[model samples]
Target: MKTQSRWIGFIAIGMLVLMTVAPAFGAGRPETTATEQVTLRYSWWGGESRHNAFLDVLDMFMEEHPHIRVEAEYGGFSGYRDRLSAQMAANNQPDVFMSGHLPPWDILPWDARKDLSQFDLDLSYYDDTLMATFYAPDGFLIGVPQAGGVGGSYLINATLLDELGLELPSMFWTWDDFAELAQSVYDASGGTVYGALDEAGGVPYANAGPPHFDISYHNTTITNENGLALTADQLRFTYEWWGRLRESGAVSPADITAQADDGANSPIVNRDVAMLPIAMGSFSRFQDNTPDTLVLFPAPAGPNEPFTFGPGMSYQISAHTAHPQEAALLIAFLTNRRETGIRMGTEVGVPASGMYRDLLIEQGLSEAEEAMFELQNWIIANRDVRGDITVHARYNEFRDLVRAEQQAMAFGRQTIDQTVDAVVRHARNLGMNVR
Candidate 1:
C-alpha cells in the first residue's frame, strides 16, 4: 500500500511539470487570433490623395486581420528616394514600400527584397506579361506591380483645345502630325498659350522620343547588347526636332517648362499649355487639380507604331523584415481584395490585378477614371507594337544627364550639335557603349 501511494505521488509531480513546460513552449508560438499581434511598417511616396486612400485601405486590412497592425510612412515624391536609400543603408528599411519601375529601385540587388513568390500570394490574378517585369534577372520575384497600367500618354486639355478651336489629334497620329498640331495651337492661341510643355530634357519625352520614335523611324534599339544603341545622328534627330519647337514658340520656354514640377504647377493646369506628356496612372489626379475637361491620347506613333507600357508602381518587401509573411499578407490584401479596389480606384493607378479592375468597372467609374481604364485596355490589345528597348540600371543618371544637356540647349547656352556631342561623350563616360 505504501509503494502504491509513492507511484501516485510521482504521477502528480510529472503532470505538474508537463503542464508548466507546455505553456512555456506554447508562449513563443503565435496564437491564431488577435491575442498574437504583429506590427509592420509600410512606406510610400505620394500626394495627400494617395496617402488618404492608403490609410483607408490599411484601416480596412487591420479590421479584417485584427492581429496585424501596419504603420504607414508616406510623403510626396520629392526626397523619397533619398530617404529610402538612407533607411536601406541603415538596414532599417520599412517592411514593405512603394517602388517605381525605373532606376536605382529597379536595379536593387537580388537580396534587397524578399522573394515574393515564397509568400502565399494569389498571383494568378495578375497579368503574366506585367509580372515578368518585376522578376530579377536571377529569376526571383522581387516585387509585385501595384498598378499594371500604361506609363505614357498625351494628356490634352480638351476644354483648352476646344476654346482654341483645335480638334484633338487622331489616336494614330505621328510625330510629324504632333509637330504640326503644336504649331497650330500656338498660332490659334495668338502666341499666348504654348501647344505643349517643353519636355525636351524630361524623362517622359526621352521615353517617347529616342526609345519609341527611334524604333519607329530608324528601326534601331535605344539600348542593345552593345549598350546606348542610338548612333549620334539618330539622337540628333530627336534633339533637333525639339530645338525647332523651342525656337518657333510652339512649346513652353525653358523657364516656363522648368517651373512645371507637379500637377499643381503643371503648365497644363495653369493654362499655359494645351497638352502635356503624362503617365496615364496619374491622369485622374491631374484632372482633379484643374477645372478643365482632360482627355487621353496615345503618344504620337512612329512609322512602326512602337510604344512603352510598364507598372506605375510596385510593392516590395524588405529582405531584412522579421515578419515577411505578414508584410506579404498586407501586399496581397492590397492587391486582391475587392474593397481595396473600390476604395483605391485609380489613385494608385488602375488596379494591376484583373480581378480588382473588373470589380472597379462593375462598381462604375468617374469619367476621367473610365478614360484611363479604357486606354490601358487599348494598350494591352495592341501590345504587339510595344517598344523593344531596355531601361538600363543607370537609367536615372542617364536621364538626368540628357535633361541637363537639353536644358543647356534650351537656355541657348549650347547649340544643338554641341548638345548632341556633349550627350554622346558624357554617355560614354557614364559607361554606356555609345556606338
Candidate 2:
C-alpha cells in the first residue's frame, strides 16, 4: 500500500510540473523573455523649452512602460556637436540622440548611427521626400526626421517695419527686392536700424549663384547628398553681392553681423534691423527672444529655383545600443504618436507625420507656428528639386575653409575673386570634385 501511495504521489507531482511548463513550450520553442528592467540614455541639444518638453514626453513614456527608464542629456547647441562626436568615437554615446538637420563632418565617417529599419517601426507615416533626408550613403535609415519645413526663410520683425512705416515685401519677392527693401528701411530709419542681416551663410547658396543657374552650394545628386557644387564664377557672384550689401549699409556691417550671430545680439532680436532671413526652424526661438511680434515670409527667390532643404532636424539611434527595440519604440513615440506631437507642438520643427500635422491643426497653433506650417506647405509645392543636403565626410573641411575666406571678404580682407579662387582650390585639395 505504501509503495502504491508513492507511485500515485509521483504521478500527481509530474502532472503538476507538466501543467506549469506546457504553456511555455506550446509554440514548439521557449520564448525569449525581456529583461525585468532596462534603462536607456537619450541626448539632444536645444533651448530650455525643447529640453523640458522632451523630458515630459520621456516621463510619460516611462510611466506607460513600467519596466523601462530613460535618462536624458540635453543642452544648448554650443560645443554639443563636438561632445557628441567625441562620445561616438569612444563608443559611449547615448542610446539615441539628436542628429543635426545635416550630419556634421566629424561624425560622417564613423558609421556610428544604427540602421533603424532593422527594427520593427511603422515608417509608413512619413512621406518619401522627408524620409530621404535622413538616409546614409549606404542607403540605411540612419536617422528619423523630427520636423519638416522650408528651412530657409526670412523672419521679419513686421511690427518694427509697421512702426517705421515700411511696407512689407510680398511672399514672392526676389533677392534684388530683398536688397532694395533693406536699403529702404536703412535710409528711412536714418541709420537707426539696418535693413537686413546678410543671410548668405544661413541659406546654402544665398550669396553664391542663383539655383536657376543649375548650381548649388552642395551636391544635389539626389535629395540628400552634400558636396561642393559651385564654380568659381558662381562663388564670385555671391561674394560680390554681399560685399555690395555691406558697402551700401543696407545690411549690418561685418562686426555687427559677427555679433548678431549670437542670437541675443541679432539685429532683429535687438530691434536693430527690420528683417532677418532665417530658416523656418528658427522662427519660434527667434520670436521668443524679441519683444516685437515677428512674421514669417517666404525666402526671397533665387534666379533659378525657390528651394531650401526640408525637415529641419533629425534623431538617430546609436549602433551600439543594446536595446534597439526599446530605442525604436521611443523614437516612434516621440515622432509619430499623436499625443506627443500635440504636446511638442512645433517645438523642434513641424512634425514630419502628416497625421501629426493634421492633429496640430485641429488642436490649433500659435500664430508663429501656423506661419511655419504655411511656409512648409508652400515649400513642398514650389521648392527646387532637393539635392543631397546631408553633409559629406569632408563637409567640415569645406565649410571651415570657405567660411574663413568668406569672412575675409566680409571683413574687407579679401576680394571676391580671390575668395572664390581660394575656396575652389581648397575644395579640390580636399578631394572634392569641385571643377
- Highest-scoring model, TM-score: 1
Which stretches in model 2 have alpha-carbon errors above 4 Å?
1-33, 101-110, 136-139, 200-227, 385-387, 390-392, 428-431
Per-residue alpha-carbon lDDT of model 2 for 198-276, expressed as tens digits? 6442323232222222223322311113346666665666667767877887887766665565366667888777877
lDDT of model number 2: 0.70
**Sequence-dependent TM-score of model 1:** 0.84
TM-score for each candidate, following the candidate numbering: 0.84, 0.82
Worst 10 residues of 2 by lDDT: 215-224
Residue 325 CA displacement from its true place in model 1, Å: 1.2
Off by over 4 Å in 1: 1-36, 103-106, 201-215, 218-227, 385-389
For model 1, give the 10-residue run with minimal summed lDDT. Answer: 25-34
Residue-level lDDT tens digits of model 1 in 190-255:
999988877664433334244445655766545543557677898888778777887898888888
**Candidate lDDT (C-alpha), each:** 0.76, 0.70
